[model samples]
Target chain A: MARITREEVERIADLARLTLSAEEAQALTHDLDTMLEYVQALDGLDTQNVEPTAHPLPVATALRPDRARPSLAPEEAVGNAPEREGSAFTVPKVIEGVES
Target chain B: MAQRLGTLSELRAALDDGRTSASDVVAQALGRARELAPAFAATRGLRADRAAEEALQADQRRTARALRSVLDGIPLLLKDNLNHRGEPTTCASRILDGYVSPYDATAVERVKAAGGVVIGRTNMDEFAMGSSTENACDQPTRNPWDPTRVPGGSSGGSAAAVAAGIVPVALGSDTGGSVRQPASFCGVVGIKPTYGRVSRYGLVAFASSLDQVGVFSRTAADAAALLQVISGHDPLDSTSLDEPVPDYAAALDGDVAGLTIGLPREYFVEQGVDPDVLERVRDAVKELERAGAKTCEVSLPHTPYAVATYYLIAMAEASSNLARYDGVRYGHRATGAHDLQSMYSRTRSEGFGAEVKRRILLGTYVLSAGYYDAYYRKAQQARTLLRGDFEAAYRSCDLILTPTAPEVAFALGERSADPLQMYLSDIFTVSANLAGIPGISVPCGFARDLPVGLQLLGPALGESLLLRVADAYQRRTDWHTKTPPEAS
Candidate 1:
């Protein structure tokens, strides 16, 4: 039985960087457990020699010329940013004790 | 009832022969879109004025005998996930509530270059996460066949728009049956090209590996025309295939004589499939056989594990892809955050809908330490087995046929509360996506007064063959000719 505990759910949520309410966390425990149990059906399949296929089609990483080309203007690139200052995106400070 | 417009080819002929102006066609389609809004809820927004201006340009080009392909002056709707410069590219999510794209998607750019006027953006599931369109941040798109039922999603709005004749063709991104399932429900033709066949440059990522931009149209020929226009290699997308794209429209000779089609026994006997849907699909096979196509039974032993494998991989990728919406750059940002971490968590919590959050959480769980090998890795290996199944099956057959979905469109909110039930709706369509093959859903027949779809899948880079079989079936059946009463 693939049972996910409430603590485990909270830990996963933290790792995912999602803020969940107490109710959401509790409900997610049940949902996750249900889904996990269902997918466990795959556990019975014999895949001893099978290679993991990460991509559906076989594609080698494509390389392109390194020459610089015209790109989006800074103003246009950050046009959708919720907070911006002079073509730079403004965000909450990452380091504590840092001066703005 | 509003009178429906003709197919893309018919419209093109009208424009070329001076029977109707591009402005007239665009105006008429916009008028119908507005009138059908309450019943179908297909369009999230419209660009009627801008479309009219583009239509005038197209007419001017026609007058100068300089038409740009058959798509010149044709109006089409874009699934909202596709970026169009200066237009809102919300993937029907609150996170992207007011986000406007700064450039056009590669597909959108190609359409514009061909003189196709962008009419509007259609609604979809929040971040293309759900089977039904109910997850949209805006309103749910109703099936044109029955307003009380849902138009299957996350391309429901695009399917509904095409099914209702609001536009003859529309672009939709298919990740695990998003395009085909909705097209089946709405009684329109939808095609998902081989993975990497269509460039995903500006498409909002759902599950990057599984996502492929597809097309919806009233006929296979029309779908072919549109696919030909938007397909081909794009340097901007590293994953886009570098193979030469054939003339898909010309490949539609409506002849499938002596072609071998394999019917996977597992799909027909699956537990949850509606009997009527299976019967309709069987009848379609019989029709194809009578038209000189040969059919044989094949076994894809690992088919039963496709749903589980698809979800695990899709969610895992979605979790990683969606981490970009961290309230730092574009999209919705939360207020009252004291730290960067809080800003991200709170903003995502406030922006995402239920289904999206659930997938993200599940994805995180599978990829987390200790459980990674048990779930994520196992699913990946199983995906390889599933792909092997298709590869082996294709060794004897040119194409495979199955039902596009388990059943016809269901009522809104019917399966909304049960996530697993909703997930099962894509059972018949996801395998093609998993195997990276070309697949198309063509309206086959009606069941219980609703349309049913017959899906045809082909090998990788086999779009021409898939379209040929579907076009031939369409020529023999009148199901694609029937219009929903709401728009007739």
Candidate 2:
């Protein structure tokens, strides 16, 4: 029964690391409100004791024995990197945009 | 015309007979693509040199007594998301702009092994996150049927390319109706193979478990050929099936005498499905009845919650899968790095589009502390009921029938303004992904001159049976071969 507020939407965007323009935040607030309203239809279903299913297939708890598997060379793994520096995968830093 | 009147069958025949060259076919397709490019804007990546190499090899095979398979020397298009070796696989995202894959997807490898030439990669909704092509980061692919209207997405380009006669067949992926929706709008045959029937290795993971490789073609037979070539086990993808590939093309001949087709009661009424599209679907069902198949009105009791549950699960997977795109260890990196947060924030905020950002935000929140049990876990429970609805329907029928998309293609800006309206475009499609079943969309009829598709959804690994039913319908109807009006 709780409505998605503008602040909640803005905060969620912040956590998502997205800088939302006011229009976007306002639009998402309205959209998320409608979405939650529609999603709430499932709340009325009688699933009190029923267990939730994660995957549809019958996957058992099994793994190949812990034998040494052939490993891709570091170069092989780094070969596909869009940014590589001396055999190590290099990446752009993102966290510093927010002030400490 | 895109090419001469030969169907995919005839096209492949000429290739095998050495009467046509693969390079020639690619050249012809590329020429048509250039001519019709204004109509649908159907392409994203055009691999001219690689296609030339493939055509040369195919030419050698034609000269010798070598035949690879039914797909030999056939030029095909791939949606932008599927990884291709030596070509950029951008998935229509700025972050991945200029990013290239070093290996081919298992499905791509299999298609090439069958002697099919990958001529180009088509456009799509950025990260396959939207129902209309308007969400594409670059240009929106137009519907060949109506130049001003959209080709449905996120597989719009694949559909338009095939519909415009640019390629007899193309590869597409369906997470939540990506292939089938556009297949309908473009009036082509689109088949989303049963989950794991085709390996997803190197597909760039948009909601991993829900994503399955599918195909788009002008006919059911073309789709069958593509599916057979790509269906098999790969040691690389654990989910790939080891089951023997069935004779899908051969299975097309089986009579539909004893088949029970389910007409879901909810899929027809007040669910916002357009009446004209529903009417065409009903006519297709009537045609099936005339083919000696019986029809039953069935119920998928939990049909209403399908979209919500689909979004929850897909977003959860997407948030996890997209986590790998962090600006480290590969992909686009912002040059100015004051700190780690700045790096991630600038990279992601700049890298992703609005829809992708929106979904990621929603997904992250649902999986965040305090809300996981309520939203994410509850949606998982609803998913079980949604799957059960399909299972119950199947108990009374061999396959269930419905309209592929709610309506035919809308104008470019019609649904672009409202994301929710676009989400509703997938109401009839999301359930199949929820259940991980094989679903196909066949050209049934037109609504207001644009194409409408009749969807046939079948059980897991039921590709053979599904194709037979579709083939029967296709044989009885010429709608599948009916090209869009504007393309003509």
Top lDDT prediction, candidate number: 1
- Off by more than 4 A, model 2: A65-76, A79-83, A91-100, B1-6
Global lDDT of model 1: 0.92
lDDT of 2 by residue, B1-488 (tens): 54533557978777667687777887887778777777578998788788878888887887786968888778888999888887889888888866777678989999888888888889899999988777888789998888888889999999888888888899999999999999999999999998888988988798887899999988788888889899997877877777789888888884999889999998888557788988898899899999999999999988888888888888888877887776775567666766666677777877888888778877877888888988889988888888888888888898999999889999999987677778889999999988889999999998888899989999988998888998889889889767666665
Best by DockQ, which number? 1
Interface C-alpha RMSD, model 2: 2.5
lDDT of 1 by residue, B75-112 (tens): 89999999999899989988997899999999999999
Residue B45 displacement in candidate 2 (angstroms): 1.4
